[model samples]
Target: MCGIVGAIAARNVVPILVDGLKRLEYRGYDSAGIAVHTGNAISRVRRVGRVAEMEAAAAAENLQGTLGIGHTRWATHGGVTEHNAHPHISFDKIAVVHNGIIENHEAQRQQLKALGYEFTSQTDTEVIAHLVHHYYQGGVSLFDAVKQATRQLSGAYAIGVIALDRPDELVCARMGCPLLVGLGEGEHFIASDVSAILSATRRVIFLEEGDIGLLTRDSVVLHDKNDQVIERAVHVSDVSLASLELGPYSHFMQKEIHEQPKALSDTIEAVLENGFAAGLFGARAAELLPQVEGVKILACGTSFYAGLTAKYWIESIAGISCDVEIASEYRYRDAFANPRHLVVTISQSGETLDTMEALKYAKELGHNMALSICNVRESAIPRASELVFYTRAGAEIGVASTKAFTTQLVGLFALAVTLGKLRGRVDAQAEHGYQEALRQLPGSVQHALNLEPQIKAWSDKFAAKQNALFLGRGLHYPIALEGALKLKEISYIHAEAYPAGELKHGPLALVDESMPVVVIAPNDALLEKVKSNMQEVRARGGELFVFADLDSHFSESDGVHVIRTPRHVGVLSAIVHTIPVQLLAYHVALARGTDVDKPRNLAKSVTVE
Candidate 1:
């Protein structure tokens, strides 16, 4: 969930490493640090603060070097302190900046302490530095030392290392985490993400599992587990630099929330032109979709919520049994292996380590027909899957996802309609009607965006409340979960969601005047049931914030605030309802003075379990 950037170049790379970390600031970090191989020794500057502080400290120290590794750390092993920051050192011989957990760090730390290696930081990453130093003391090269140290480690990691003795070379490796080698003119870079080093190089080699890379100023040598040289495809990242800029917006969350319309349109452009078919997922999807009898969706966080919403559409409309499992939990349990069941993985950044591991676990259980719905076209999950669908929600920098969630719904809905048609669940006319509705999806979402002013005004009053209850019924219940997730993620308000029918089960006890209740009451089959639940809240003096359809006839009253979304669009109402919900969360965060773009302890991509 942290960020890593290493640069080997002829010119001073301090600025490059620093700027890379700044670009990656959206990935959420509590501390920032950098270690540079100076003229004769490794110089380090670690700070328990933002990138700007680290940059200033580096400037004060005149930390000039042609090669360095930098990190923005999300605290994992220890407390958020300078002592636990990255750029962990080992007797000043080796410095490592790592992203992801080292599962067996305690064992390594004990062994290292026994071997007379002193530790300065309380971090799993420090074990890596010490282990590499221990191996290098045997007169082995840094590359072999890193490889040996990595062999003893268990768990996901992407590490960039610099040795004082090997200032000319930087060794990096990845195991179950994303770490790419960026090829530049007379320079080489290693970063956990392509966006971090986009300024220095667009051409990158995405390392595979157990891949180790040795980098110099002018060349990069990659080797697989057996020490045999390997070659992976070099992908030219098309992430425009402008996409990273906030432009007129105050935060990335705001920009991404408003960008959903175009993002949704682009995701379904191919489907809109050629009609919804199994081939839209992939050329082999037609062959695979026909063989599917059930579906198991594995995802995490916002992507998991998207899967929950998709389950309603697939089961109700496509007439297929669907199950949504948290990717992190999927590996812990023994799944009922069924080869005929289609395994679908959803992720905004295909590099989410938990979901990727779940995908591998699903494949191991004889479920080989895997499909991925992801935003990044060249991400690992899509590459690993037999079938893939891109969300086209380009470069989501916000830690709390907006466009990515809505766009994933678009892809999932398309999959539902395609499956419905193939299974005879939907007739030709019904399929055509679904297509027409999809064609207007972008416009419908845009119309929902128009409710932002109303939502923002309501947020001024809602932000004062500390707890909230988001209620919906049937198809809209997942949306209520999503709405609650958004409010708690960005606004830091305690929020919970429940099926409207289950309000009296337990959640109703928490509702009172101090509690704000957000309800999704579209004019679906259960609109009356949802309205009854709203009355239940209002009768208890619980303030109500409702996002209802224009046809629902919901209006503002004493302690009740209503924002009119577009007319209900059936299962697609979930998509339209998401916009106002997102806006409310964003504006509430603004009112509460919380970090909307990078929420506390949350990373844009969950690359660690």
Candidate 2:
């Protein structure tokens, strides 16, 4: 994933571009660069590190301009270096910043080389600048040249272009990646995500696939692939600027973990008011539910775990069979679907490349009954889907997601209950009871968050371990997977999750005193079976960290530490039980001196395959 930002202003633009890049730093941080059109020429400054590095260079040189494009790269096609950084320029010095892979760059490079174009960097993005320069040399306008160049390129891309000749205008286009235009007074801005431009302007125009926009200081013009003019609608965002800050917390991850209580409460409040379900999903589900035969969920990383959890919720509550598949893998599979089948895609960033592609593929298959549960409004997932359920989690800056994941679970849970009521699977009394529990979830989640101190204390004991095992059954199995994933992602610990019953087959041999086994033992039908598996681990002298219900028979002992969670029923318990494991991973990583915000070789948004 990479972040792109551009601005045309009546005043100095370099500072604005750099500040935007700072807001977008979470999307990518490997390298940073900016290209500005000064009075006489295009000035380019780039460095192979954080945005601060490039900003230092810019300040040292006193670079000033009123039009510029900047980028923070995550290094997909080439190694992270100055040569591979963005704001890549052509021989004529025109610059471009891109946020997606150019899949057919090799062939384009070969053709350019045949035309005597010399290459300077090992990046697919460089080919775009050269291609634009190639067309510009033939007397095409900069806007037309960029449009023509895109016709020769293949694969996903969201590009912002600026040239010396067109010093007053910045051109942008998107194909299967996210790019947005921010509307302001006497100024216009473009960025890969809204967080970058929110301070300058809350009103935004989201660019669609195959759509192009030309930006000037005063106006923005939209056009389709054929260069035909199109009307653009402006959407004002409701996210407060304060939500992006970490406040008094030590880290973004810790702040986000603590924010879960409020996030969940907000989501529950939004979903459970009197007759809110009828107003929100009643008519929509009535129109779409009877036509749906099954569901296909497309997601990646933590959102994929939420999808897995939703599979249990939908099947058990609505009597609908659902399949959860990774978006990257789902795009390549020959899965069968029809107009009657619904596709549900989950993404926090909504710019996840594979998940976006999967949504595109489902649309191509004529599955119009599409629903997206996303946090960011006007994100690509919401743009590509037929219906959207926006998560109320404000802004999740931590690379290891906390509030976003829990809020997504809440959204999916609400959707499942709504669907169950619409399909007659839930009687009125049962629906009311479920709604009451849903209303109480926010307070329950706050109580769960209160258990963090206990979880942090437990994490102190296991921070030195090199490996840990997580086990659960039924709906909790996905919770186990998510817990293990969090530990591995942030703590750099080698962790694995298995169904408690599968322990004896292979995972049991790895158990010993040095190894820690974490079990999700909420009171359920499978609790006894999971308890037996815990006994097996104890027999082998394995240390245990169990998240169990207070009424359960499990108790704390010397070899075992028990974290008691409030009692919850059905799939809701899995949601409540996940908080402790998330806190454990957060605290463990904190204790181990790991970079919890930006883990090694990980990006917040996976925008490429």
TM-score between model 2 and native: 0.97
Counted clashes in each candidate structure? 0, 0
- Candidate 2 clashes: the total is 0
Evaluated against the true structure, the overall lDDT of model 1 is 0.90
Model 1 residue pairs with clashes: none
Per-model TM-score versus the true fold: 0.98, 0.97
| lDDT against the true structure, each candidate | 0.90, 0.87
lDDT, model 2, position 580:
86
Winner by lDDT? 1
Q: Which residue pairs come into collision in candidate 2?
A: none
Give the lowest summed-lDDT range of ten residues in model 2.
274-283
**Candidate 2 per-residue lDDT over residues 1-609, each given as its tens digit:** 889899999989999999999988776479999999988899999998789999999999999999999999988888889989989899755799998889999999999999998888899999999999999889988888889999999998999999988888999999988888999999999988888888899999988879988899888899987778997788998878888887899888889888887888877776667432633533365577667777788999889999999999889998888889999998898878777777989999888888888888888877888888888887878877777788889988888888999999988887777777767888888888888877777667777888987888987887899999999999999999999999999999999999999988999999999999999998998889988999999999999999988778777897888988887555588778878888999999999999888888888888777
